[model samples]
Target chain A: MRVGLDVGGTKTDAVIIDDDVHILARTRLATGWGVDAVGATIARAVDLVCGEAGIAREDIRSVGVGMPGQVAPGSTRVAHAVNLGVRELDVTRTLEPILGIPVRVENDVKAAALGAHALHGSGSGTMAYLNLGTGVAAGIVVEGQVWRGAGGSAGEVGHISIDPAGPPCRCGQRGCIEALAGGGAVAERWGRPGALPVRDVFDAADAGDALAVALRDDLARGVASAIRVLVLTADVDTVVIGGGLSALGDRLTTPVAAELEAGAEASAFIRSLRLRERATLLPAGSPAAALGAALVGRTTEEVLAHG
Target chain B: MRVGLDVGGTKTDAVIIDDDVHILARTRLATGWGVDAVGATIARAVDLVCGEAGIAREDIRSVGVGMPGQVAPGSTRVAHAVNLGVRELDVTRTLEPILGIPVRVENDVKAAALGAHALHGSGSGTMAYLNLGTGVAAGIVVEGQVWRGAGGSAGEVGHISIDPAGPPCRCGQRGCIEALAGGGAVAERWGRPGALPVRDVFDAADAGDALAVALRDDLARGVASAIRVLVLTADVDTVVIGGGLSALGDRLTTPVAAELEAGAEASAFIRSLRLRERATLLPAGSPAAALGAALVGRTTEEVLAHG
Candidate 1:
């Protein structure tokens, strides 16, 4: 058996899976802030999940935690997980002795990518999980293994500038994909307070508000560009869109598809790619992140060097 | 000994290498039009290179050919090699019987990427070869193996639109990296007849021509965008610029480096990536394409699957 945890900014999701990857138990808890609190939260969640699974802690073979941050390749230390309010944390050191299990850590988007591939991929090709969260990023999985690039910055597509005149990005560029499509960027551009700012923007666009309509279009354009980048650069078989904004479902995917179709209409090269058919939305509330964490915990080596 | 051939639009470069990858002999010949002529061209090049090496053709273990076209994964058939005046050709069918040796085919840019990594890469890290040819494209090599993406369009970064409002591309897109920096596109934009139109544009820009200045800056911008795309999407350890236009050397790399530096100035995030340091220029007349072809010929399996 293996245990997995998705330590999010607001919540911690836990799962217990058997050898065949069957989910034996699942639980969620509100996440706490900072290092020690976060560690304690993981411990509590682990215990709760074990109880829910009706198994002793000794039954678990390994634990994996996925979070929004930089997890160095082949290491359990996470850094700059701003969303989780974690500056630095050694996940193995924090949880291994307490749980008496081997521990591994991976970036949340990467873990989700692995899990999504397991659930939705063709089982024999490359897939990119494009996360549209507070910041935009992607995680690529090839043949079921997450691509852990040099310096661990692979799939930082959010910073690729698509337009010189588009918009100012917080990353100091103009017209970054994240600047246009990220949930936080859109909310800031909308200048409106709402629990679901992206959903509100979509609703206002439906009502024919000019700015809302423009933001909505920009979101679609950014997403379409990201799809093109993923296909052209990595040539993944499909792009699975997930993240907070994905909750909009068809409201988001429809326009993004339209944007790709529009580009295809103008360019025969783009038309031939049949990009629209290759993009799909990850079902909302999928346990991909935690499930992927469990899978990751089982890998002996996440890095490969070819001679 | 292994034989490698770069069957270009105008010239066919051939090389013979020993088991240690040491070049034994190198020769070039004018390529012919049509399928039969191309087949004859390869045979002639092989004979000529073997003579140059003072070795018999029977000693050759395998022959790998790299050309501009679409090569399906693990296949020796090439499609849409327009510059070579061939719509479709099965290289293995045409050459194997003639040579009595195993023949492997690969895209020129992809071959060059593998070759460049072998020559200039850190050997164990990922690298991208950005080919600034008549059209812009990139080939990514990870751990010394070319990343042949699903469906074999893995490195077609030329069509990625970096500026929607900047310029129209032959691919029917606006502001594609190719449209801005491609040798063909820039010459078309310049509308001047010159053997080396890109170099002419650079020289004219140095002479203070307004149109030339704009075109030159666009080339730099396009190249910079391509480097960024490679780094951000694939996180290549370095981007080695090659292809026909790379002959401009410092006139090309200097401005491209400046463009990357300019982006770093605007964003601390860009600064952290050290993109300028990662961008490099392949040496003039480097045998990367043919060498990479030779390397590809030796691989028993270019594909992998994980479960």
Candidate 2:
């Protein structure tokens, strides 16, 4: 048995699973702040899941946590995790003693990609899990392993600006896809004066709200550009959409697919890319990040050793 | 000793090298038309290089060819070499019987990437060879191996449109980086009625011709975007600039470096990419593609096996 924890900006989710990855138990709690709060929240999830599974912590072979920020490979020390107000913090060392198990921590998006692969894998080949959430990022699976680049920053496509003449991003850049496609950006642009919540922005577009429709189309373009970048650069077999914004489902995917189709119509070479065909969606209500965190340690060890 | 051949669109370059990759003999001949001419061109290169090196065909261990288009892994059957104006040609099977040695073929850009890694290798790590020439493309090396995607269409970044409202590309696309950055595009935009040769375009820009300056800057942006794309996706340690257009050298690299520097100033996240520091130039007069071709068979075998 193993344990997985997804430490997010808003919530901390946990899961305990058998050897075959069948989820034995699961729980969620509001994510706390600081190293102590973060450590306490993680400990609570681990304890609750262990109790629910009716298994002792001794039997958990590996416990993995996926959190935001730049995490050192194979260790729980985060180089920087601004969202969690973490910097150079060693969460693993703090949690292992409390939980009575060895723990590993990785970047949250990367863990989600692993989880998506483990549960809804296509057997073999590459799959890029694009998380369109509060922030935008990707978890790139090259073959069956995560492709952590030379600086441990392989899938940092969120900040890659597609439009030079577009709006400025909070990442201190102009025209980033994240600035254009992330949930916060959508809410900020169209949810002003509390007129349209981000949740109803899509429904408003469906009801023919001009501002909402334009914003949604902009989001689609950004999403399409992300797919194009992933397909053109990495040639990933599939681009699975995840994260909070993914709750919009077909409303988000359909227009993004349409944008790719339009691009293909313009270029035979771009048509060969088949970005639309390569795009996919995570199943609804999938706790992929937590589940993926559970397997992060073993997978990271195997991949780093092999790579 | 091994024989390597780079079958380019305009010329076929060949080299005979020892085990340490020391060049013993080298020659170039005009590239030919049709499968028979193409096969004959490769055969002639082998014959000439062997003669110059005072070695018999029997003494050679391996002969490899690098051509454009999609090459199957460890096989010489090209899916389609548009630059060569040929499709689905089996060059290896055709040459092996005549040469009395097994011949392997690889994509030209990919071979150039391997060549770049072999010649100016940083021991072991990812290196991206951004070929900004007649057409724009990249050769990606991950852990001393070529990263051929599931469809063998990994490094076709030329058609990745950076500007949606740019111009029409021959690939039936609008606003591709190639449309704005490739040598052909530069010539088309600025070359007219003895205005400037493609070779003199940069010199004219240096002479302060407004038109030439604009065209050159456009190319710089495209090249910069390519580096950003390569780094953001693969995070290669160093990106070596190669291909015919790379002959411009610092005139090309300086502007590209400047563009990346500007992006860094705008975004801390972009700064972390350190694109300028990672950008490199292939040594002048280097026969990287041919030499890389020489090592292609062995390297391809190792990588595909490992992958």
- List ranges where model 2 is wrong by over 4 Å: A191-197, A299-307, B191-196, B299-307
Question: How many clashes does each candidate structure show, in the order listed?
Answer: 0, 2
Per-residue lDDT of A119 in model 1: 77
Q: Which CAPRI level is candidate 2?
A: medium
DockQ (Cα-based) for each candidate? 0.82, 0.67
**lDDT per residue (tens digit) for residues B1-307 in model 1:** 8898999999999989887677899999999998878889998999999999999989999898998988988888999998988899999998999899899999999988877887788644789999998999999987668897877778789999999897899999899999999999999999989999999999999999999999999999999999899889988888999999989999998888889999999999999889998888989999988888877756434312100
Q: lDDT values of the candidates? A: 0.89, 0.82
Residue-by-residue lDDT tens digits, candidate 1, A135-231: 9999999877888777777899999999999889999999999999999999999999999899999999999999999999999999999999999
Candidate 1: C-alpha lDDT? 0.89
DockQ of 1: 0.82
Best by TM-score: 1
Best by DockQ: 1
